[model samples]
Target chain A: MKVTGAVKTGQRPRGIETSKDGKFVYVAVGDDDTIEIIDAATLQVAGKLPSGEDPEQFAIDSGDKYLYVANENSALLTIIDLATRQKVGQVAVGIEPEGVAISPDARIVVCTSETTSMAHFIDVEGRKVVGNLLLGARPRSAAFKADGSELWVTSEVGGGLSIVDPAARKTKQVVKFAIPGLRGEEIQPVGINLTHDGKLGFVHLGPANRVAVVDGISHEVLKYLLVGQRVWHGAFTPDEKYLLVANGASNDISVIDVAAQKVIKSIQVGEMPWGIAIAPTRDR
Target chain B: MRLGIVVLCVAVGWCGVSFGEPSQQLKIGYMWMKPSKIRVSLLDVPADNDGLAGAQLAIDDNATTGQFLNLGFDLVDREVSKGEDPTEAVKELADEGVGMIVTSLDAERLLAVASAAMAHGQLILNAVAIDERLRAEDCRGNVIHVAPSRTMLSDGLTQYLTWKNWKRWLLVVGSHDNDKLFADALRRSAAKFGAKIVDEREFKDTGGARRTDSGIVEVQRQMPLLTQGAPEHDVVVAADESEVFAGYLPFRTFVPRPVVGSAGLVPGTWNAAFDQWGAVQLQNRFVIKFHRPMSTLDMQVWTAVRMVGEASVRTGSADVAKLVDYIKSPEFSVAAFKGQKLTLRDWDMQLRQPILLFDGRNTVSVSPQHGYLHQYSSLDTLGTDRPSSKCKLN
Candidate 1:
């Protein structure tokens, strides 16, 4: 709705997430192979953390004890200890690993590899990969269900969404998308979001310029909300009233009214925006 | 620290279970002729591993994905020496049990090799030789074209020029036969795109020292004299495949008109300056491995190798017939960081992709420009469409 101060990080900053208290924001600077920590109060880069080769996406655990980063070039999921600011463990998954999601219980972590087209399940406590489930080609993002019962992974090139049973380590179902005029290759599913109640899902269709609203329980397509070009990722507001999507090519963010399922505003942003994270509101 | 135990678990069997089947070896052949011609500019010189390096990179890319599929890829590159028979070299590759081949051969040699490979049920991916007839009158069922055709390149450039309202062109032709052929393509494209060639001239090759230390001063003086006295035109289009004069036409033109064709704002499948559509990642990988920028031939060969990898992944087999069948099918599409999936035309077996119009330092724009529409794909507007194709693949 309005302009805000911006902080410049290293080249090609991709994934961003806030700490539990929202005091610091960790960003995976992909080209720099490091994470830039931005202090919330100052809105400036405070420090840097050692990330593995070409870190694309990372997830912070619920307990705020550890950070799981998907090293895209190294094919390893690097675990970093928050308190000590040290590399704690590494689990070899698949090639071009990206799209990290830590389960609600903080016991399981899902790492999706782009080239290998597999979602690897890691035992956070054991510091090892427990299971692997192959999905569509070029898997880009992973999101766990509200209760951590299922995992949804977006396959950018495969143009589908895969729902996996984390406990059984099997793909339970796959939801495919199709638009009337667009070709199959244009329907690439990139970033996925699920409602807190687990009743609705929003799948970002890259290049197709539309966000698919799905019936989360039945996994059926509800409607397609038209948005900006090359939508990469999205984030829900702290109140869940709006969903803000970063359009990479358009260099803008489209704000959609979650309840109405329509675009309400388009806020201009920097060039080729990839990821978005909304921190909780603080008292003045 | 539990690093040792956790690493051992993954190293031994924990993560290994994710891979399916035992690794099956997929061997591919890369046949190329050593670059024989010297360029006018040192920057235009071809590297020793020009085409082969791209195939090697693709092999590594394939192996990365192959690791999860329990597949292993190996590239066996063979350089054909002077007076060596390319057909025999292809047979040698077949003897080594390599059924898929990516080649950077001339049109004649490629046809002979394709004929020889047909007996062994091998598929040939043509990574060089942009002769339009190869995709038209000389089309073969076993040969798939990765490089853009001459007409495609001409059309790509012409579309952009037309979009800019530069309809009048002063066409310059070189004396060599290859240059003449490219000039024909430019003429065809100009006619198809409704652009008029206001004037045409030929620069005869008189056999002189054009690459000397003082050649720049001579070219700068001679270019303006040569380009002068032409009819009214918005651009100068030079077709000089022999590298005789096109490079000199830019910035030295008499009328200060922009240049296009083999010179300024050239149309190509890939350019060193192109970094959009996830191409920077590829460029970084290539530069890190080869210590050089990826050339157009390298990108074409890379696309060819990646096509084979994609087919194998989709069909789940290394059988030559299966791979060829899947690649020729309509459902087959391979991504080469081109912003879209490239598919083969059923009639010509030419890969459909957007051509980048690039200068020496930057990619100015991509062709198949907006407002150029087609019933099926806008990419069809670049070259011979399905209805007008002379190819009838068996």
Candidate 2:
């Protein structure tokens, strides 16, 4: 209902992820080329870790041992050791790497490249790209299923959602979106989020100004919930009651009631709000 | 005929694979007709590979996506020097099994290549020719235009001018075929947008040296005289695509009015200062790769290549027939950092996109302006609509 607080991180902050314990929020400051650590309790920048050029999106390992950042401009993945908060190693992926996702088992990490239009799979132990699966044009974000059996990647320009099989390293199904009156080009799928129970999935259609709710099992678009202009990213509240989306052009975050599947309120944020990360309450 | 045979032989040698290879490779040929010399101010010289560089970058992008799908993409760049027949370049690319070719040439040469390539059932993407007739009476089914037409550009500028309440325009046209065509587009735009052309004049290109030791003094003296004696007008619209005098009229006009069209505050597909809708990332990537800021030509060629890339990926094949069919189909669209996906117009095959009005420093506005709307799309507001199209593509 209200913006708890807002903090200025750096120019063009793109991707955000909260720590497992919800103590720190990692914000990818793209132009700054660094991951700024925001202390959840104080809502202040605690520390920063150097990343590759134009880090856009990142995901931490299930064990919370390492953090993987997708360097969009450099086309490389920078791996940071969470304990020391230092760069441990780097893996060459593809051109314009924008999305990073770690599997539930923490054995594999998927990096989606926008220009490359491929999901490069990295072996966590070896820290090397083991394989790649071609995707549609301008793949923006990737999300893993609850069981990690499948990975859903949103292609912004392709205007579709590619559901990939992790074991086979191939796309099993592609779910395309179309509105009756809107042209196909207007429905650009960008940010994606899957429910913990894997029953529902939310895909942000960038210029379409709607978030598509798909039935996870059938992969059918259940509803097109209207949001704001050029929505980019989404994060779930700690209690799983609400899904908050950062609408980049509108400069606000649209709050969706999870049970009702409708936008309840739009919380105003800073200029061009791109990414969001919700911290778990201490009571949890 | 001999050049065509030699080109065919070279093409057959390069692509040794049979027609039905399991892993299909899509080879796109970029054919450029290089002008022997261009007249421009000392600071405005163009890069040697202006359009080709953008194609190269898009090639890299295509290959990145193609590698996973077993669809390999290759770019064969051929430059036709001045005085050489551009048709030979198109024939050579066609013989080499290139079903798609991106070209950056003037209208006349582009028409020759387009007609020649169409015979072989090949598709051509016109990346930098702004001639409106190409999409109108001279339209060919084989050619798809990525560049914005003169009508589109003029209408974009006129829309912004009308929104700003600058109603009266003094039109100055250069004495060249292309210049006159552009002037016609401006005239049409002024009439459609409820603006008045108070006066019109032609600046004769008196053939002489474009550059001299004391050229500045001469240009400064002649520019004011060239623009003098016009009726009261709010702005001066110069159609000098020939680059003969429009650049000199910006600050040197007789009445101190803002100049537009071919120079100052020109309407284009892309600009270096345009950063909206995540274009800054594209600009940064282009600069990092090429070591220079992206230009309008670069953006046009990039979009052309990206169109081919999108079609190939969506169809999951490198077959030219399939790619062409997909592109012409209602489903095809490509995103070029323009806040929307650009689609091909079924009637003329011109890519429908928003035009950026740049003032040489920053983006002033984008057209398909706020108030201008169409039943189908706002993009239709800029250029020749379906009702006005004389193009009977066959």
Candidate 3:
């Protein structure tokens, strides 16, 4: 409540990632080649790390040791040592990368580029490009199960999803469909959410303005749930019982019952609050 | 039949023709839906917060603008779900022979609305959805996007961050897995403009256990340490979509730096508090219509409606296709909050406009302020330009 400034950055920020110990908060300052860190208490800046150009997408290792940033313009993954907060290495891949996910073991990182039609994986320990798996056209964001066994990537242009196997370094499944009352092309699939158990995954379809529930194991789209105008991403509650979709154009968050797969409420945030994440309430 | 054929061709590509001469009822159809039940708490939103506020704004705006042209416009709001069959909803509107429709649904729904409208040879004026895919792979000739794409919004924010010289940042996210996705956008922006992120952290959504008083003190103590050792940072950026505690960042932070991104300076389509350049006047009018503050959804819908009014005043009829073409033309302009004017890109049908960078409380600056120039138009600096766009108009 003390620090007052402008939120004159990013478009619909989705995530609010804090340190493992809940010390610092890292925000993806969309469209800028930088991230903002604030002291959790005073909410002040303690430092800055170097990311690639146009870095909107990012991933952190298991121990929170390494931070991987996907620079959209340079099309490379810039790696920084969390301990030093300095750029240590880089991995070049794809065009206009937007989404980033790290393996459960923190051994690998996956990034999805907007137009590249692929999600590239990097070996976190070696800091090198290790995998490039084919996906639906215009993949924007991806989701990795809590255990890191499987991954789901959404294709905004192709209106589908690509499932990958981190252990096998291959795309295990591809799911596509045409829902009524939507345009085929605009039926772009984006934003994926997986349960902790990795049994159910929710995807926000770009043009469809809805989220599709998929069986994570078989990569089958089980059902569709209405979200909002251009629903882009989903933010899950700590209990995983609720899921909120950031509807880019609707300029609000559509709250859904994950168990029911239906929107129960809609809350107004700032305009296009695309990047969203829910943190466990402090034990206050 | 021959004469009818010629008339149809002329209608398909009508341009610069006087339409106001004829007092016609402007026909329009819209498509929308209710989201699933689960998304409520996740977004920290309420159910009644649907974007209908935008639809109301358009109707009010037209009420003011309609006096000059005598163009009577009426909108029939049709709500549909995933399996509800938009074909019928769209047909009901098209059956009325409404050519142009302003919509605030997802990309697929818009496409369905567009196709259904087009099947009846109608045009769709999309008022919402910012996903780049709508402008890229899913783009259509019959659809004109009236909303600013995410690229535009992000780029607008990025330019200001670079201008502010607060190049270094420390980012914080919430526990939702999607926090990384937003962090991705911030990362991209940082990379493009030669900025840097000191470090990143995740705040777990460990359920609402705030009845006691242990979490805040611990988080307060822990945050400063995590950000330690980063040479220097200019700002603290927090992406708390869940609004867990990042809203409490800034000032409490260990170091003194300007915080931007989500909490500090925020970029959006429209803000209820935005009044600079008399933006409050528009806001007031919108509040009168919906009895609540207007959001980005209302703004986008207001823009689409205002576009119709602008083109109708200039071209004259509800001849939907003709009006659509007028909007798509580079010459078209709309008066939004930004001081100057806004247009549309020919290649991808993206809106060309300036962005208002607000420091949470007030407006700090606007992007593309003469210094930021592009080869095509200054608006090119707002988002992906012709050279960078892969959208091919078929």
Candidate 4:
């Protein structure tokens, strides 16, 4: 629990993800419209990859062969071949695309557009959109079930979560949250995370300053853990013992005990913290 | 309604199919009359498609969201000439199956259109008329206001000034009828917000071209001289809705003071320089598409059209009555890149939104300034509250 040396990347950095081997980290530089690669070992700038306009969120395949980026301004998903470091194809999507999630098998990718409120499914093999599933308003994040049977998308403005039947390309169910003493419009659902076993789910309620714990199997709300202001994005540690959430407005991170379903600690972070990335524990 | 069927068919045909389901077309009508006004600055001139552009952009945005829901949106724009009866225009759009119309018209024309639309069982969203009567004594159940009433704008500006401790004000009002009405709103705001108007002066409109080579010297000399010897005040509030002398009051005031209201630091629902609360994405998209900055009128029309889209999406249908009821319901709220969700006032069907204080180049601040709280929503602090509102819609 200490501070690491910071590496300046680019302006308005949004989504971040580590490579499968945890060797490199990719950051979507939104304002710069390029994905910057950071060498995890050296904690230094590695290289840059060309992306579409206003790239916010992206997904890397399990094989780490390609990168799929959601370009908010361009309304296109730019596919980059990791090894070649070149954009291979572009698939037109709905407006203001923000979230990207690839299935466990890496055969399918789901891109969620904020304004369009659609979860577009793309075929990795064909490098094209296969189908689209409509959800609530302003869908910001997406996560697939461990078995790839269901895709869960969070609608920030719609204040609900839509669980889609991935194979059939239809919404299986929608889970809405109603907190006591809070208005319905305040219950905005943003980032979502599911346990490795897929038995539990954690949803960061943006501006609501709370995390909803859901029974993964039942897709029902189990409990709510109050967090910081504007709880934007979250990530689980490699061991999956604790969950860390970035509070964009509060400029801090709330650490939750996965087993206890409670907030254990608050860690101060950079101003307006957004996405979070955790690397594998290494021998000191 | 043969025209309505033809337009509806074209809209549905262009949208094609969404995931094998034929798209359900939803058309919103845009009816407006261009305001012919000359301003001191070329930048202040209104674009030919000021409000229409906003509706067009909203249609594009709605269509994007509609794609996933098997819903499609289209805009049918109808422009009326001066002294033209807008009833025919309203009927034409209604005949085309357009159940919702967004208008940027004067009070008279807007009222006429509303009456005509009500006959056809269509709803109207007023995007431009700021006359208080439209939201008060003349309030129509069928006409929902997207534009902030004059009192709302005045209150937004007054709150910011009051928060800044600039409580004393020198009011300069134009003689024109609209300007006088705006002046009344400012007077009401100053009284309600605990600011005292130290003194007031009237600026008569001497008929002449707004722009001329010798005009600047004359205005420069006339403004300060007219403003001279006025009671001491912290700010000079101008009410020149006719685009007469407000812009010239900023730096040309006799006493060194900040100018506000119709010029200088102004209050509006949207501005070209607003980039907060994820508004930059919208501004960027608009600039890329329209090749110009988005104006307050544009944003108003955009909000009006999006309101229709939101209702259609929530109710999952294009039925006019259902959508109207849903919009007027407490359940309906819309996100317009504002920090919080905007809801319509159930009392008068006026959209409640945060007003931006623009200083021409950048957003100076937003109204409902911190600490000005209301029991329900802080936004209600800027406009006609339910208790004070004269609107009686059943």
Interface RMSD of 4: 4.6
For B1-394, candidate 1 gives per-residue lDDT tens digits of: 3576456655674554444443577899999988855776678898998988899999988876676567778898988876999988888899999999999999999999989998999999999989988998899999999998998899999999999999999999999999999999999999999999999989888986786789889888988988899989999999999988888898999999998997888899998888876577788778989999999999999999999988887777777788888999987877777766688888899998889999989999988887787767778898888889999887
Error of 1 at A29 (Å): 3.1
Q: Which stretches in model 2 have alpha-carbon errors above 4 Å? A: A179-183, A281-284, B1-23, B208-210, B225-232
lDDT of 3 by residue, B279-310 (tens): 65567556665677676666777777667766
A112, model 4: CA deviation in Å? Answer: 1.3
Interface RMSD of every candidate?
Answer: 3.0, 7.8, 22.2, 4.6
* RMSD of each candidate relative to the true structure: 3.5, 6.4, 26.3, 4.6
Of 2 and 4, the candidate ahead on lDDT is 4
Per residue, candidate 4 scores C-alpha lDDT tens digits across A61-106 of: 8777999999888788999999999999887778788889998888
Residues B235-319, model 4: lDDT tens digits: 9999999888898998899989999998999999999888876688888888988999998999999999999998997788888
Q: Which numbered prediction scores highest in TM-score against the true structure?
A: 1
Which ten-residue region of model 1 chain B has the weakest summed lDDT?
A: B13-22
Give the clashing residue pairs of candidate 1, or none: none
Sliding window of 10 residues with minimal summed lDDT for model 2 chain B:
B13-22
Those runs of model 3 whose alpha carbons end farther than 4 Å from true positions after fitting are A1-284, B1-22, B34-50, B81-88, B111-117, B173-181, B203-231, B239-248, B251-256
Give lDDT tens digits, candidate 3, residues A1-284. 11233244443243456666567767766445567676677767666667655566676665668887777655567887878888898766654566888877777788875434457776766555555665654577877888777777876655567777778867777788668644343466767878888888888875467788888677777888887787877668778888877887887888889888778998876666666655542100
Better of 2 and 4 by TM-score: 4
Candidates ranked by DockQ: 2, 4, 1, 3
